[model samples]
Target: MTTPARQPAEQQPAGPPRPAGRLVLAGAPLGRATDASTGLAQALATAPVIAAEDTRRLHRLAADLGVDVPGRVLSFFEGNEQARVPQLISALQDGQDVLVVTDAGMPSVSDPGYRLVAAAIEAGLVVTALPGPSAVTTAIAVSGLPVDRFCFEGFLPRKPGSRRRLLAELAGERRTMVFFESPHRIAESLADLAQALGPDRPAALCRELTKTYEQVVRGSLAELRDWAAGEVRGEITLVVAGQPAGSAQVEAAELAELVSVREQAGQGRKEAIAEVAATAGVAKRLVFDAVVAAKRGG
Candidate 1:
């Protein structure tokens, strides 16, 4: 007797689409206008209502797509997202599809659309997304560090102590990490990353991705910190190699080597420590310990 063949998983039906009068969180181009998806353009051109982080940018994007935005557009941003959600939800309840777009990237990832998305879900409104490029992922891809698993810490606190405290919390993270920082503070933040994580840890400074003058500089965190110190400009994304397992025990020896090499290369103690920790993919504390031990002949 012949046995019946099992059905392939690909044959499984994906359930029906959610109702139409829902909220669509769309992604805008981080840079390179062509990165916008077809679905995003369609939604922007025809959604019954468009909730944009920047209405002027929305209009500019519509012009780029050569499509007039006929929908009613409302400004929704960090300051106004919570307050504006109720009004937007009321539109969804009335069977209008609302599209939420940020100036760049997906609306809710380090952006202002999370509140509205949460509100819509609670209101039993269908929610969807229009996928697009993300700086977090893009920077990680080009960072030359392990990306099998990673975490995005977004922007760290502005204050030095607070920022250092946050980095301390992440000292044990084994997965690669991504962060965003302002151009003005990139130097200080990188120095902090070097100090907290380690000077020799591998990292990349991604600037103006996908735009003209797009640059990805891969070096030890300390080197990038020094480079940033001179004169840095543009939106910045930092991708750091994660802490290596068992790095603590061998840190002293590694850091000794770092100090020796950098000293020979003409870098001073502070600069050597920062570069060594960042390049070694270890913590700055480890480098500091090694430096102290070297001084004491331990």
Candidate 2:
């Protein structure tokens, strides 16, 4: 025999096996289709199981993006999200990647998919996200208010009384507040906000963001309320300025006088006290004590 056969070419070792499955929460565009991310396109094209808030909307989005969704599509909306969680989790356990998307914006911010994400995490499944557009952040970014700190207050209660109570509770919140409202209730909600947070509170009304009729109106709550009273349309997001800094340090005498003035202006004792405390950014109890002490001295 001539020479030994040349040694076979060395081969690289295989990498570690990936987990069986993963849950990916992809954010859709708030309004415009072009805002969708490339990761969304890739996930739409490759994910084995796609759970969408609306399968029809998902298909429409895919068409707009010129991407073909070759995977199985399933409905994952509020109406059926609870029931579909188990099935989606099972797919993840089988090592299949599942993509969760909503009709607009992120899947869990004022949308469905939170339950599925929690369940997936509980089941030891890998959960990730593809960042894209979000109505909350978009509204806040364009609000022209202090964005250093903010809070998202999804949608207010549908019932007026419940909504008013909730607003009253948050009247003293020191962080910029963002709220989502329906076209029909935007006016009423703004009016309630004006009453709860005071008419002079600065706010912005962002409507139909990233869409054809996009508009952002910056003004006091009273001004926004008046504007909302007219023929307002499209998805609405309200951004409210937080209480002024140092307001919580008002002197006890001044706080008492403010409470007295509110009482004289027709507010009930408790209501006046609460309103004063909120406006002053002080504890309600402090206001209450000041009011009590003032009454005793009188």
What would you estimate as the lDDT of candidate 1? 0.86
Return the lDDT, model 1, position 173.
77
Task: Provide the lowest-lDDT 10-residue window in model 2.
Answer: 244-253
Give one digit per residue, the lDDT tens place, for model 1 in 89-199.
989988899999999998889899888888888988899988888989889988889989999999889998788868876876789999999999998899888887879
Best by TM-score: 2
In model 2, state the lDDT of residue 23.
93
Q: What's the lDDT for residue 184 in model 1?
A: 91
- Collision pairs in model 2: 20-95
What lDDT tens digits, residue by residue, belong to model 2 across residues 6-53?
999999999887567889999999888899999999999999999999
* Local distance difference test scores for all models: 0.86, 0.88
Q: In each prediction, how many residue pairs overlap at the backbone (N, C-alpha, C within less than 3 A)? A: 21, 1
